[model samples]
Target chain A: MTAIQISVFLENKSGRLAEVTHALAKGGINIRALSLAETIDYGVLRLIVDKPKEAKTALAEAGFTVTETEVIAVAMPDRPGGLAGIVDLVTRHGLNIEYLYAFVGQRGENAVVIFRVDNAEEAITALQEGGAHVLSAAELSAI
Target chain B: MHETTPCWNREMEFMEEGHLRPLQSERLRDVVARVYERVPYYKEKLDAAGVSPEDIRGIEDIVRLPFTSKDDLRDTYPFGLFAVPMEQVVRVHASSGTTGRPTVVGYTRRDVQMWAEVMARTFAAGGTHIGDVVQNSYGYGLFTGGLGAHYGAELIGASVVPTSGGQTKRQVQILQDFGSTVLCCTPSYALVIGETGREMGVDFAGLPLRVGFFGAEPWSQSMRQEIEASLHVDALDIYGLSEMIGPGVSFECLEKGGLHINEDHFFPEVINPKTGDPVPDGELGELVFTSLTKEALPVLRYRSRDLTRIVTEPCGCGRSLRRMERVTGRTDEMLIVRGVNVFPSQVEEVLMRIEETTPNYLLVLDRKPRGMDEMEVQVEVSERTFSDEMSKLETLSERIGGEIEETLGLRVSVRLVEPRSLERSTGKAKRVMDRRDLGR
Candidate 1:
């Protein structure tokens, strides 16, 4: 129904993203997906990792400002119109998606998509009712 | 006065030590009695010290009097320490204080006259005279510097150009077009204008700008040489605080060695900063002053906190008043940037208002290439305020910069460093990194 996401504060400078990767590498955690949103002053490194709690600790101990939030992760058929179908279903359900990122993993011909929506419970209910395989925190980690 | 010496008040400037001591003693005793009788703050301080006006028979009994610190001024606030009634006070000036409030000083008509007289000496000590066009560049409004030098220049029958501060190119143009013979501003600002004139292809050596009075912040002897060469004029140092009637406290004469204190009005003493006891002549200690002739806001044995030595030797200028070595440093952590007082705690106060910022901060201070003060405050981003958004962080930095400017009256660029990026030592963390070389 919901997945854990780790967010880190990064100054918009060289080696900042490298530092985040370095921290995760040192902590022996795998970053499943990440989206970098930036401005002139600083950036926010949104990370979906195999172990969110450990990644947060590693980044925090490495002198990074880190936060943990809940997100919606779903799997769809790996086809041309798969993303369009799921997005249209959510839009028809009147659910707002704040941001979304995707990772290509062929788990029986399906792609994983992580979403940050306004209401995670409602988004999960609507997606499940629409026959979408909504992934849980455990299922996202297992992937 | 001797023909070799040029002084504003011939009688007082050349008065022998024997005559000046008694005059100071009489004035000190009178002011002590008047403050005790009129000001409640002084009355409480004197009574708490178990000393009264009768105990202060002359200048010799000044030690028995309690010392007034800036904290005492803060406690009394805006006008609680004024000795005279508001009806008799003619002017007021203020300087930024450590706390949110500013230190205010009020002056009576006669007190204003005394400030002008001492400032006149400050001008004449450097050989400025009538018919000289004095370009007064000190800030004019609430600060005493601009108006203090203005009144003195006019009192000496000299034409004044109240240029105030800023606009370096315009200042250079005025120096060229107005034919100003005397210059007044901070040492750093003088360097700024000198460099601007050079860049604008204005030759300073060809101009008639003879001398400049620089103060409001400390500069090194090397800086004096730099300014003299750049501006092509004899640069002298003028010292004062708003509480002491601004810029005429003590001044460097043509000798350009130590500054001569106008002891007739302000009595100067050097004391061990920790013990508050008087330091011997020629030994460095904190400089303290007692206002002898001031009426509106008379202060006795006010701790100045400036570190310098007292030299009682007769100067080649033939002035008998004791001179102080140029101030070496301060006993406190106050930073004087572009003639304004900036405290690290002041910045901390501003940063604390924003919940996202931690209490730990570092202030990096430097001088621009053209010679204006610049600062950057490095603050750590907190975990609670972290978000998956960039505009929120940008807004945080801008809000910090705005609040700091409003509080300290200084334009400081805010730098949001990463958490744990700023050093945390086992002992006291160093909060300030002063990069400007004032020969320190």
Candidate 2:
């Protein structure tokens, strides 16, 4: 029900993104899903990886300021209006989404979307009650 | 046991005004004639002004002589202004010049001794004594702060710990272990050391640090209070310029009233920056200095561009030397936004008063598309205050912007950056970034 997301504070300089990826590659860490939010001076690199503790230590050792956050993964119908339906349901339930990203599930029949909400537990309960499938941490990690 | 008076050289520091005036006149005449006879640059400038060495009869005629500016120094790059021959010149120092050619200064053996004497006076004014542990943290090499303080401490017979800026953690350790009685560096660097020391759980109040001499950059009174309270030391301000000499031109005595200028060796004048006329005493004006005893590189009425006023009123320290108020801003560094003048020091005062932010900030100036000047102050917040909550962040920004507007009388946009985002400098922090040219 709760997946750990690793976020990094990156200065918006040339080759910084490459440096992060290279550090992870050398550490044998694979990024499952990622999103980057940037401003003129700096950016935050949000990443979903297979190993949270290992990735955090490696990134920290590589001189990156890393933060571990809890996020919920929701499974949506692999159709035209899948994301739209989930968004409408969340909007109706009065849940706020800070940010989200989607990736195809291992089965290819459903799309798993990672949602970073203000309240992860409440968001998961509301989404489950709205008849959406929420993936557990172990299930997501296995995928 | 130290037997020297609180004033380094009792004879010179307490010299009566009558004696000082005649000494200045004699030294002024000798220096003017020396420059005119040896340096071709000064000879041409003096000839063009229709004045000669003989025309400079006394200190009163200093105004009649031509004024020298930094541009003139740049024009005569390496040795054009050295009055003494290369064989006679013993040492050389320079400004970083980050922008263009560095202004080079040469010193003969006597010139070096004169520098050391003024610095010694500065130390004594701050109540430094022989056998005291002096921690010199100002950067060394081409910059004068390091060597200037080093030589002065040695001349005063103080044990010199030439720590020379950086290694903040170690600086704190040494302050505790060495029992340093005096600290020397820029005020901002001192703050950095204080913050680092606190982070390392060093007990500054338990340390034996008695006095600190901070200079090489403009700082506000609020910053002084912060440094004094945090570092557990009496913070004193010292002023100088590489153009004339460094770190010993004037200093604050224990009275902490105003910096007593070493007028016997360097004559100071406050003048209207625009019209170049001497201002009445106690009126704010640009500072100008004429080196009366310098031999290697003598400046005649060199415009320091620092905005301050000279206080002829005698100080409580019993020294007859005239004191100049702490410089508020540089005439060249002042920014005009929407027809209102502002100095970075003013912004610094406002920012330091706010508890949520650190003193690290940058004033960015740009010309808007509507053809009006705009200013944006990018300030750094403490790690605890920086949050992902947009509302809270917005509120902090608005509060800072309002305070700046209330203090400086100008509306400015405030950007609260994360901790350590603004560039930090080991010496003379860069506080302003003029991006108006990018708009063009």
Q: Against the true structure, whose DockQ is highest?
A: 1
TM per model?
0.59, 0.64
Our model 1 lands, by Cα RMSD against the true structure, at: 18.8
Indicate the residue-level lDDT of B322 in model 1: 85
Candidate 1 residue-wise lDDT, A1-143, digit = tens: 68889988787789888988998999999988889887665777888888998998998888788899788889988899999888887878788777888887746587988888777778888889899999889988988
Q: Per-residue lDDT tens digits of candidate 1, residues B1-440? A: 47778789888888888999999999999989999999998899899999989888878899899999988888888999998889999998888654668889999999898899999999999888999999999999988999999998899989999999999889999999999999999998998998999899999999999999999887667678889999999999999977778899999999998999989889988887777889889876789999988988999888988878898677888888889988755768677888766767667657657889876789999988888888989898887776565556778889999999998888888888777777762234688999998883
Q: Over 4 Å off in model 2, which ranges?
A: A1-143, B1-5, B336-440
* Model 2, position B96: C-alpha lDDT score: 97
lDDT of 2 by residue, B1-440 (tens): 12333788888888888899989999999999899898899899999999988888888888898999999999999888998889999989999998899999989899889999999999988889887899999999999999988998899999999999899889888988899999999999999989999999988898888999999997767668889998998899999998888889999987888799999888999997877999999877789999988888999999998988998787777888899988867888777788776778678768878877888899999897778888999888654444433445567788999999998899999876656768874456788998786535
* lDDT by candidate, in order shown: 0.86, 0.85
The most accurate candidate by TM-score is 2
